[model samples]
Structures are given as C-alpha cells and as structure tokens.
Target: MASLAAGASFAIQLFARVGATGTTLLRVGFASLLLIAFWRPWRVRWTGRQLLGVALFGLTLGGMNLTFYLSLRTIPLGVAIAIELLGPLAVAVTFSRRVHDFAWIAMAVAGIALLLPLGGFARTLDPVGLGWALAAGALWAGYIVVGQKVARGHPGPALGLGLLVGALIALPFGVAVAGANLLTPAMLGAGLALAVLSSAVPYSLEMYALRRLPPQTFGVLLSLEPVMGALSGWLFLHQRLAPIQWLAIGCVVIASCGVAAGAAGRAPEPVVGPEPP
Candidate 1:
C-alpha cells in the first residue's frame, strides 16, 4: 500500500513529462517485463479456462489503470481516489450480511458527500475527471472479483500475464500521445521507478492478499488507499485538502478499521487446488 501511494506520487510528477497514457504504458509495460522474467510463468501449462480468467483479469486491470490515470489529469489525487473508492464500498456492502457493515458503509458515504463541491473549501472538479474516476472504480471492483478467482491458481503467472495484456492494450495510445517524449532518458528512468513502486511490488502483495482474503474484506481494507493518496498528494504534489475533506478521510478510515476488527480471527478461504509446480 505504501509502495502504491509513493508510486502514484511519482506518476503525478511524470505526468508533467509524458502525459497519462504514456505513464500507464511505461508502468504496466516495465512491470510486465520484470514480473514475467522473474516468475517465468510459461513454465506452467495453463488450461483454457485459466487462460480466459487471466484475460478478463488483464482487461479489468488495464482499464482500471488507464481510467484512473486519465482522472488524475484534471483532479487532485486524493479526491479522485476518494471518489473511486465508491466501487469497493459498493462491493463490500453487496456482500455484507451484518448490520454493522451497512453502518460502516454509511459512514463511508458521508465521507464521500463531504468531498462534494457543493460548498465550503471544495471547488468544482472536472466532470470528465470524475467520470473517469467512477469508471476506474467499476473496473476496480471487477479486478478484485476476477483477481481473487485467478489468484486461487498461481499468483505469478496470473499477475504477469495480466499486466502483459494491459501493456499491449495501452501501447498504441501511449505511442500516439507521447511518442518521442517517452523515449528520453529521464522518462525511462522515472517510468522504471513508477513500474517498480506502483505495479511490480504492490501488485505482487495484492495478489497474495487476494488469494487469502474475502472480497468484501479486501474491498473495505482498501480504504487506506485514499488516506495514502491524500498524504502523498499533500507532501509531493502540494495539493492541500480542506478541513471537511480531512474529516471525510477520517470517517472512511474509521469505517475501514471497524470492518477489519470485525473480520479478525476468521480463517482465510482455502485455495481451490495445489499451486502449479
């Protein structure tokens, strides 16, 4: 989580140099290469159904990255993340069986409402950016569901191949927009850093976590992402938040902690079968 936050900060800095699509391509592309080389995923013989699962996971993963980056173009990272979280919140609520879960979700909703530009220190944000963030959120939910299913197999092959698919989808768009700018030495260096911090490290951990955790638990736990994003934006991007927004973050954080506490002591779901040798 820390790695993802730090990577997002770096990505915002790189956006000034290469644009959103370029950054997405570089991050996903480099990450795919690194993971594939390390895991040597081709050693495992994948069944057709498993292959299809990875393809769907890759589609969601790629779409999520692309749309989230696009939102960052016009919105502050924290606000964008806060709005994007609605997807996970919805997922959590959908799977929730307890009353407290709904309460936590309501608190999260309150937090989101505080982020609205209706009044106070908040200003109107770009509708397009908000739309993109919402789209990213939907894809994020899809990624969580699909990732859990795929992670039941081998974490390495699923993540590496999924990223490769994403990189392929992003390649042409990145080329069309950034072109020669992306080839600069500085851009390459930054892109590598972004890939490591953003995609490679955190995603590996996320896949492992997804394999063990329930989807609703996984979704609610992601509330930390907004907090991390907000801090990173303030520290690195100098994007300050209003007092109300900070309170909003607090609400979500508390809600997440509550959910985590409730879920404590529960045994993780078992993996479907033995990992590929």
Candidate 2:
C-alpha cells in the first residue's frame, strides 16, 4: 500500500513534466518492459481464451491508471482515492448475500454524496475530476474481476503480458500529450523510479495477493489505500483536506472495515477464475 501511495506521489511530481496521460504511459510502459524482461511471458504459447482474458485485464488496467491520474489534476490524491475506492467496495458488496451488506453500500454512497458540490459546501470540487475518478473506479472493479481470472495461470507471465497490452493501449495518447518530452534523461530516470515504485513492484504484489484471496476479502483489504493516499498527499504534496472531506474519507474507510469484519468469520470462498491450460 505504501508503495502504491509513493508511486502516486512520484506521479504527481512528474505531472508538470509530462501530462497526466504521459505519466501514465511512462509508468505502464516502463513497468511493462521490466516485467516482460524479467518474466519472459512469451516463452509459452497462449491459447485464444487465455489471450482474450489477459486482453480484458490489460484494457481495464490501462484505463484505470489513465483516468485516476487525470483526476489528480483537480482533486486531491486522497479525495480521489476515496472516491475511486467505490469500485472495489461495490465489488465487495456484490459478492455478499447478507442483508446487512447493504449498510456498507449505503455508507459508501454517503461518502460520495458528501464529496459532491452540494448543500453549499465550504469548497466545491471539480466535477470533471470527479467524473474521471468515477470512471477509474468502474475500471478498477473490472480489473479486480479480470485480474483474478488471469492470475490463476502463470501469474508472472500473465502480469507481464497483460501490462504489455496495457502499454500499447496507452502509447498513442501518451505520445500525443507529451511527445518527445517523455524520452529526456530526467523524465526517463524519474519514470523508471515511478514505474518500479508504482506499477512494477506494487502491481506484482497485488497479483500475488489476488490469486490467494477471495474477491470480497481482496476488495476489503484495498480499503487501506485511501488512508495511504491521504497521508502521501499531505506529506509529499502538501494537500490539505477540508473537514467535510476528512469526514467523507473516514466514512468510506469505516465502511470498508465493516465489510471486512462482517466477512471475517465465514468459511473462505473458493477463488473463482478461469483455469489456465
């Protein structure tokens, strides 16, 4: 979690050099290069089904990163993360049959509502940023589901190949925005660090955990991300949160904890995913 937050911090720092999409491209592109070189996913021949699943995984992963970075342009990192967490929270709630699970859903909804520019809030957040955050959240949900499927195989190869696909997806947009600026020694060096901290290391770890944990449990665990995001933003970016925003973040965090606690005693569900040939 700290790695992911630090990665985001590095990303925020680079936004001035490369636009949002360019930072995303550098992060994903460099990470993909590292993973592909290390894992060499091409060693094995992939069947059509395997390729298709990984394609979906890559698409969602790329989209999620791009939009999340875009949101940081206007929204504070922590606030954006809190709003984005709705994706995994929804995924967590979706898998549960309990009547009380709806309460968690309601809490998350309230958190989002509070972030809206309504009731004459002390400060209004950018709606465009909010929209991007929401889009990131939706794609995050897709990533979690698709990731589970792809990680059931050779997790290393799946991750490497998936990220390669993701880099390709980001290539055009990144090039359009940053042009040759992305290739400078300074930006390249920073991009490498950003890739390692944000994408390569953190995403690899996430894939490891995703394979072992049930979707709901995995989603619940991600609840800590908003806290990490908030801390990173405050410490590194000097972004201060309004009292109401703090309250909103707390609401989501608590809801995440509630969901985790509710699921604690139950027998763990079998991980559901496509078996790799």
- Highest TM-score model number: 1
lDDT of 1 by residue, 28-84 (tens): 999999999988989888999999999999999999999999999998777788778
As a TM-score, model 1 comes out at: 0.94
Model 1, C-alpha of 78: deviation from truth (Å): 1.6
User: What is each predicted model's overall lDDT from 0 to 1?
Assistant: 0.87, 0.83
TM-score of each: 0.94, 0.87
lDDT of 2 by residue, 177-238 (tens): 99999999999998899989989999999988787776876886687776677778788888
Using lDDT, give the best candidate's number: 1
Backbone clashes, candidate 1? 0
